[model samples]
Target chain A: MSGIFNSSIGRKFAMALSALFLMFFLLQHFAINILSVFSPDAFNEASHFMGTFWAVQYILQPILIFGVIFHFVMGFILELKNNKARQISYAKNNGSANSSWMSRNMIWSGLAILAFMVLHFIDFWIPEMNTKYVLGDMSGMHNGEFRYFHELVEKFHSPIRVGAYVIAFVFLALHLLHGFSSAFQSIGANNKYTKSLQGFAKIYAIGIPLGFIFIALYHHLTGH
Target chain B: MNLTLKIWRQKNASDKGKMVDYQISDVSPDMSFLEMLDVLNDQIITKGEEPVAFDHDCREGICGMCSLYINGEAHGPDRGVTTCQLHMRKFKDGDTIYIEPFRAKAFPVIKDLVVDRSAFDRIQHAGGFISVNTSGNTQDANAIPIAKEAADTAMDAATCIGCGACVATCKNSSAMLFVGAKVSQYALLPQGQVEATDRVLNMVKQMDEEGFGNCTNTGACEVECPKGISLENIARMNSEYLKASLKG
Candidate 1:
């Protein structure tokens, strides 16, 4: 309903929904990207299918973009409103005594991830779009071969880029460390199952980003 | 114990406050923090200077009237105790203690170490009640059997003393724990179900209007709460609000 997004709870609920959506997308993205390490042919096959498939390209991609944008915009708005709610901060706040550093610094971590997203989009998504939509080349091919694996390898050849990526993934881990379980709490899922869910959240939070870092390093060290 | 006190001094609502330092000696370790402040105020009175003003009632801690941010921790360094209940033994001899009011836009300072928390009263006024028939008809207390678990949970939610420690300690100054406890105290009971929808919807509306921040589930409020109100109450309120909104 229209009124649902107006209240604090409603706004948080919306944020949680978008967060869960984006989390799912990240998992699938990681799944595909990991293929570049194990099997470049399979990676290219998955990448080409993902790129060229009409349903994924037309339907899911737009929703994914919207989810990302919505999450960021809403997060910014909440952060601004929350800052204003204090007006004047405590003379000396001992936030670490009660809350985790990651919990308190979600915005900074999120900003780091946002910066990474911009680089990621520029490095991969924009060029993919240009090749597929702008240049009218939906074939996922360049010079009679699939370009996905070669382009992926080419992108990882730079140590600076890899370093930036590794740092970004670290930030992503911090973000998810708080965010994954936090999204569940926001949606009112706190119960007997919450403990196990937190266990799973810890694994996903550390593991997924670690997995992404492994993929990036694997390509960078091996491809060279 | 000899202590140097840095207490916030503000004349009135419009006055900009500053921390004013005073030295006090022979403070008994058994004395409560408020009692220590009383000793300091007595020292100022003897010096022919105006004494510092802070809110307190029933010094035993149940009234929730006492609020002091001491040494960067709400209710001082003690866990699970109100400022009135915080004993001086926690601090070392010759300690320099800093005392300030609970900081939040919703809880603006009224005087030295006193903040106006009527914003909470306003939110309470919105829906923190249930309608019961009383004209020649009243339900017996034991007429409706409540599940033991539900009753115990509701009692836990009800134990919140409405202290602003949660807000003061929160990085965002969120009052979700307070509002969530209020909502859960009702939502968990069968008597509260009839008007549950409107109660949650209206309370949340009033809560936002009070300029309080949203919960990020940092778990800070729970840690700082004297009564140990759980984060589960907040999740309960979230689910309640969601169900109410979607029902429309």
Candidate 2:
């Protein structure tokens, strides 16, 4: 069992598995964020529930944090291992001739996502948690909602932050374009349905990230 | 056609190699890539210089011995061929070409354009075979029936020439495709069932021991492989390794 993760393919399997877990996590995140557009009260209720839910706080959040760390750390380590594998590089390498740009620059894409995550955590998760738990600032509680709708609206008010987010989502889209299909390929789940899955992957890869960018843009322009 | 060649030169395994230039004219377009190298060596020898030593046996593509990373692509710019099979026609007149050995820490440069690929032999020895009784008449070869789908896939895996193109083309210097081919060939057939568990476990361990890099599924190996070995073999190998892990 230990040997499985120690092998080359074994280690890659770990990376793919973690990336898939994170992908599922992002789907839920996007769904909740999109709710703020159609109905702010519903978004607030959902956010409050997520912020205070026992299972999410105690169990799922830890797993999510672990997943993010594992994905990036393993990715960094693999990049280093690969670099060491080739002590000498080609003087003229045309990486784009065969593979996609996202596939070849996964490390860079991942780094961009990582940097975005730190800013995101500061903007939302940190303040939200500090208010609810650390500072005990949950004064605006209703039936269950904490009236946290403006937090989403407030963050998008900054043009710089919104612009940074849009750019990050672009990288996110590029990352998913490769990551969605590649995660499936790494686990050996591909079959006759692979083409359709790749097609679906293309749509999802473009759709979700673009959806998030729209949410940010809507809040910024409307100031709602 | 006249051509300028920039070929890697190293005196020994540990020597710091550099690319040396040579110009040759009257090259026929029908000549093979290795044949062009032969012309270059012949010219160098007549000028009191040591002729470049490269590894080659069969001029055809099957042997997988003629390993060269040419113009940034493995086995030259042509697809589905080895260095031995690449022809001079791929280049135009007054063209400059660069030739270098397949670079991987595991593949040490032995001489000009020749790296030690015996590491492949060692990985194969680890667990690339099936156990069977051969001292006596083994049951009729056709007695045990295999699904045609399984047979075809197994044959596809078996076609890997072990040329190290996958390793060379891989950004990480990964040997997964090569190891995947060996693992999948045995895992697909009935003969390999007896020790399928240990076979995968042992082979993966051996591959890691050889200091090869990880597979990122860049698909360059399948693109450049002379035999057109599929990336499906790597996927299949992953499944086998996972299934083997569950047996514990």
Candidate 3:
């Protein structure tokens, strides 16, 4: 509701919900991308299905884009408001005495992830959109073969691209390290199960990003 | 103990504050942090200079009147104690202590080391009480058969003394912990159930209106709270607010 979006807690709840969506999307994206390392045919078939599927293209894609945009815009707004809350800076502050570095620097890490997202869209989504929508090429074919896996491999062939991805994934790790548990806390999910949940959050945060890094490194090192 | 004090001094609410350094000697280890400040004030009085102005009343740690950001830690580097209860033994001889007021737009500096915490008062005034029809029909406190665990949790939340340490220590200057405690103190009780929805909605509205930041769950507030108010109160408030908004 409009009222929900109007309040501070409501905005945070929305932010946490969007973060959860994006994190889920990241997991699936990693799952699909990692397929290129293990089985290129499977990766191509999966990517082709996702690209051409009517339900995914029409329904989920728009929602995913909205979620991403909402997360970023809301994050910037909250950061600005939070900055205004403390008009006078502390003469001395020992933030690390009680909180972690990742927790304190979420905005910086979030911005890093945003920068990588721009590059990622440029390298993949924009071209895919141009090919599928602009050129009206629904076939998902090039050179009489499935182009998804080949395009992914071709993109990673650039050392610069691979290096950029590696750095982005590192920032992704840092962002998720604080963000995963933080989202749950924002939603008031803190309870006895919170300890185990935080443990799981840590694994998912570190593991998923590391998986993406490995996939990128595998493709870059394999020279394929 | 001989010590160097770098204390923030401002003439009034409108004055630009600056850190003025002073050297004091023969500070007894047994003296509380406030007592040591009293010693420094005596010295300033003897020299016909304006003494530092800070907030303190009970000096026994329960009043929550005293607030100081000492050496970058709220209540001067001690855990579970206010500035009034912080002992001089926590510091070494020849230590240079930096003291400043709790910095937040909602909590502006009123004078040297004193901030106007009336923002907390405003938030409290919003919904920090349960409605009682006091027409010579006061009910017995025990008439409401409250569960012991809930009562204990409510008591823990009630232990919060409206200290600004949480706001001072929070990176975002979020007052969520303070507002959470106030909300939870009522939300966890049968007597408080009637107005629970309005309490959370109004208090949170006032808190945001007062320019407190949104909580990031960094949890510095819980660590620095003199009463050791848990972060669970915040979670409770979030859930309460969510339920209230959805119900409406």
Please tell me which model should have the higher DockQ, number 2 or number 3.
3
Best by DockQ: 1
TM-score of chain B of each: 0.98, 0.98, 0.99
- What tens-digit string does per-residue lDDT give for candidate 3 at B111-214? 99999999999999999998888889999889989999999999999999998999999988999999999999999999999999889999999998999998
Task: List ranges where model 2 is wrong by over 4 Å.
Answer: A138-146
What TM-score did chain B of candidate 2 earn? 0.98
lDDT of 2 by residue, B144-221 (tens): 899999999999999999999888888878888898899989888888888888888888888888888888877888
Between candidates 1 and 2, which one is better according to TM-score? 1
lDDT digits (tens) for residues A1-224 of candidate 3: 34877888898899999999999999999889889988989999999999999999999999999999999999999999999989888778888888988889999999999999999999999999999999999998999999998898899999999999999989889889889998988898888999998899989989998999999889889976
**Winning model by TM-score:** 1
Question: Tens-digit lDDT track for model 1 on A107-133?
Answer: 999999999999999999999998888
lDDT of 1 by residue, B1-248 (tens): 99998889999999987988899999999999999889988989999998999999988879999999988888988899999999999999989888999999999999999899999999889999899889877978689999999999999999998988988888888899999999999999998999999999999999999999988989999998988999999999999999998885
Query: Clashes in model 3: which pairs?
Result: none
> Sort by DockQ, best first: what order?
1, 3, 2
Docking class of 1: high
Model 2 C-alpha lDDT per residue in residues A1-224, reported as the tens digit of each score? 76678778778789999999998999999999999999998998888788888799889999999999999999999899889888888765656666778888889988999999999999988877887788886564745555678778988999999999999999999999999988888898767888999999999999999999999999999999
